[model samples]
Target chain A: MIATLLVVLQVVVATAITPLLIGVMRQVRARLEGRIGSGVLQPYRDVRKLLAKEPLRAEGSSIILVAAPLVLLVSSLLVVALVPLVTTANIPAVPNDLFVVVSILLIGTVALALLGLDAGTAFGGMGSSRHMMIAALVEPTVLMSVYALSIPVGSSTLSKIVVARGADVTRVVTPAGLLAVVALVVVVLAETGRLPVDNPSTHLELTMIHESMILESAGRDLAWLEVGSWLRLTALLGLVVNLALPWGLADSMQPLALLVAVVTLGVKLLVAGGVIAAAEVFMAKVRLFKVPELLAGSFVLAFLAVTASYLAG
Target chain B: MNPFRLLKLIARTGRIAEPAPAAPVADTEHPIPKALRGSVQVRHVDTGSCNGCEIEIGAAFGGVYDVERYGARLVASPRHADVLAVTGVVTHNMVEPLLRTVEATPRPRLVVAIGDCAHDCGLFAGAYGVAGPVSDFVDVDLEVPGCPPRPEAIVEALRRVTGR
Candidate 1:
């Protein structure tokens, strides 16, 4: 019963708090740029207005465009439910591994790309193709990064890895460990479509990558897409954070321990927000043609991390 | 990068130094109900203008004005928009796109004619290729009339529209 409740809570928080994270990041960016930005609750307001709107569908749009948002939303939420958020303890009977979670996330990306192609617009096509290219490059790096992290645990399951290494303070100090962290950070930035990969704030047609995919969707459909992306960000970042610093995750299904895990997760999220803001402010968006080189560099780092771990083993 | 500098900047912003707060959202006679009171996503259409009002519209949402705080945003797609912010006079060339965009916007929609050009065709009033005021094309809910309105005026008009 408690496990079920935790799963539900995780889903609710991902849905409700995801926008708040985006809002906080935006406010931090504005402050960094020496401009007064909107309130941190601005995203909540945006979501509210969006949910209330009547959705508009494009002419000649197929079922792919119509259903992609819902699929993306469900897929993202499923990943959230599977991944350990407040606690590392496996929920009752729901089981998930690093590979399974990664696959689920990729499915969401593919659905979005399909929606972009189905829209039949120049911008949508451009965004979809570019997004697929980025995803194809990023996924392998993500897998390699996770592989390096999972090396110490000897088991591919997320819960087991957390249980085994949650208290290992020396885990991230090694050469391989550091490389894995760097690779994951790069993947997080790329996956979230932030600066140095794609700018989320720009509305200019020529500069868009992610925005163009949903440029044709409006009203409630757009809201669902936004919600899904935010949840995906939270899930990916949660994995990165928990993998690196799994110390506070609840080892057993205890309510008190779960509460502590929640608190720790909140601190980690705030730190993540600050880190993302700094990265956005300091790093300029690279040229589109150079993006492959950046992703390739991340993959190379992941490869080295895995090789170093193998040699050490 | 200093933590102290970051904290200090946050602390200084806490003084309510910005947002000028003169929009009277608190005292508005008709409150925009909690649900609808949050944000206004705008889809700006340039029917036919010299790009003068466009600059003013940009200023209205820019950092100095910061319409974001008031929960108003400029969206790229008309489908995601709540307000059709039409600028300048409508031209024969833009009639189809203007109508298509308005049709694309979902229901419970509102239209704002920004600048005198959009209101009564302004300087382009009897010019060839002109399709008359935005009202003749689509019903305008509110009008922000000026050769080009100021950023605050635009923000204030939006505040009225949002009823906050």
Candidate 2:
């Protein structure tokens, strides 16, 4: 019963906090540009307005095309439920390996991208192709980085990784751990479409990857896409925090401990958001051709970390 | 020197000055009125384009981009829309549907023109069947331009509509 309650809380919190994280990044970006931005709750308002609008359908859309977005949202929510936030005590975390979590995320991306192609528009097909190429590159780096950390813990379970790191402070300071951190940072950048991988800000046709896939949807459908992206940002950040920070993860079901854990996680996420915004400000979008080199570098770093950890052990 | 501090100052100072009131009562938080509760009603119309933007927009609402949490939703009829978001370019084939959408929607409506096709004609610019621009059909308040903009950008544009 307690576990069930925690799972419920996890979904509620993930849903609620996702927008705030996006808001913080926006606020940070606006501040860097010397402009005051909208309130963090502004996303919530936009979503409300969207829901009240009517939906329109295109002529050529098939059952698969219409159902794809619903599946994408459900899959994302399932992943959010699986990922323990605020407290590890609520969910039985072992069934979900890092590989499994990453795969589910990829499934969501692929499903939506394929739906883009199903739309039968030239841009949709073009966007779908580019999105797949990027995903193909991203998957290996993501797996390799998690494997680097998983080796040190002797298990790929997210909870175990966080628990092992929390129980043993000496592990995180090691050379292998440092390299893994570096690789994970890059993966976050790539997965979230942050600058130096794919810039979310740019509208230039030659550069976009994720944006191209969604050129046809509007109204409430667009709103769901926004919320999902925010949840994704939260989930990725959760991985960075739990794996890299690993401090204060609740080991018990006690309410107070869970509360403290939630606060700690929030602080960590906000800091990451600020750093990302700052980094985006300082960096230009990596040229599309250079993306492969960047992912290759990440793979090498991850490979080195795994080898180093094995040798040290 | 924290960025939030600088932005708040800038936005606050940018506010237009108005006549003084007898008592200045400030509302610290924006209220989620009862009317905005539950699902948000939406009307989506494709002006014209290759169809990539529509797929992404559809994906946003499905399982991945679930917009339901914000008490908003997409309604099938334009008469129900408080928000009107149009995708694709304004093509000759789509002008009737686009205009019909504008006429069907009520007053004080928010119009979001998503994707580069809708914004600046994108790759569909010179096509003979295209109606040229969306502004020719309906008043668009927000333009989310990309070959297809990311869901994150689309949501940001919507947030601006609510004045939240």
Candidate 3:
């Protein structure tokens, strides 16, 4: 029963907060550029409009092509259910492992990218190929970084990470945790198809990575992809903040505490979004050939993080 | 301001055009197959990639590409897709997902390897994390080879699969 309730709550969070995350990013970008931008509710309107339209189907494509969007939407929604959206207590797991959460999201990416290829278009193939390349390089760093943090905490679960943060420490400082945070931030950007890796907004087919894959989808199909994108963005940001800084989360599973956790998560998301937006504005995208260098750097950091964890442990 | 326009302005100042949308999704319905008029379905899976091929894949169904004219459609789940469109290199991290993807597609489905990465390793060859080539994981019948082949190339590959 609790699992069901948490899943429903996750759906609500994914639907309601996803647009806000996009809105916040846009608002930050607009302010940086010294222009008024659309309200935070714009994404919401876009979704509604798309849903009201008819989905266009492609010729010569097989059944995989038609069902891509539904699976993309469904798998993404499932990630929300597994994550600690507002409170950590409601997530019932063997040990509330954070690795499990990360794995679930990774699986969703696989599904979405596959759908892109299923359309059997050149761009879909290109996009899926590019996305896979990125995933291949990035997935290990994620695990290694988490392993770094898990060492100090003595647990691999999301809730355990939170619990570790709450424990009293003399200096509230650890080398492994700090390194893990840096590596994780990079992973988040790469995974989300953001700047310095893959730009979410770029439209050039050659430079495009995420957008190109979904070029065939229209109306409701596109809307779900867009929504899924937002959900993913929010979930990544939330995971980082919640696990790294769990000061205000509901430890007791009480209603009031859960509300606090929700509000706290929102505030952190805004700040995190702002930081990411600022980074996007300031840094130019590195040359495509140089992406490996960036991934290499992440690999080194993750490797160091693992070493640090082992030493500290 | 229109984000699209703003994007244009930003791109102009930065000397970048927003990535042109991939060739519009082809919506031309397939010439109905005499043997199976409506039994055909497709499923997509990304083994690993940079995403250039993904949009062209989608464009095969949009206003321009009009894939519906060919009578084939995209399915949300593998259980429903008749053909499995596989993209990217098989990566170590993505191995389990790739397996799950193949398993998800319904039986008797043709495995089409799209793009150079799916055919070979494309730009990501020799990476520590990659699981060699996609063929290392699953059997592939059709190979669409290009950094991202043009939408027409994709259509030809599909035609071969459906035998229409």
Best by TM-score: 1
Listed models, DockQ each: 0.48, 0.07, 0.02
Tens digits of per-residue lDDT for model 1, B28-69: 454343545768888899988888889998888776777766
Q: Relative to the unseen true structure, what is the C-alpha lDDT of residue A199 in candidate 2, on a scale of 0 to 100?
A: 71
Give lDDT tens digits, candidate 1, residues A1-313.
6667767766776566677778888888876665677778888778778888778887888888779999999999999888877766556565778788889989999999998988789998999999999999999998898788779878778767666666666765778878988898898889878889999988787789889999888778888899999888888887788777777776556778777877787778767976888667767789999999999999999999999888874
The prediction achieving the highest DockQ against the true structure is: 1
Computed on C-alpha atoms, the DockQ of candidate 2 is 0.07
Question: Tens-digit lDDT track for model 2 on B1-164?
Answer: 56577557656754232221232222336332343333345577877667787777765544334342233356544544667889988878788878877775644466779998888788888888877778767777678888878765565454444322
Local accuracy of candidate 3 as per-residue lDDT tens digits, B19-65: 22334333255332233222245677887777878988987644355
Worst ten in a row by lDDT for model 2 chain B: B17-26
Shift of residue A199 alpha carbon in model 3, Å: 1.5
The residue-by-residue lDDT of candidate 2 on A173-219, one tens digit each, is 88888888888888777877788887775545456676666555555
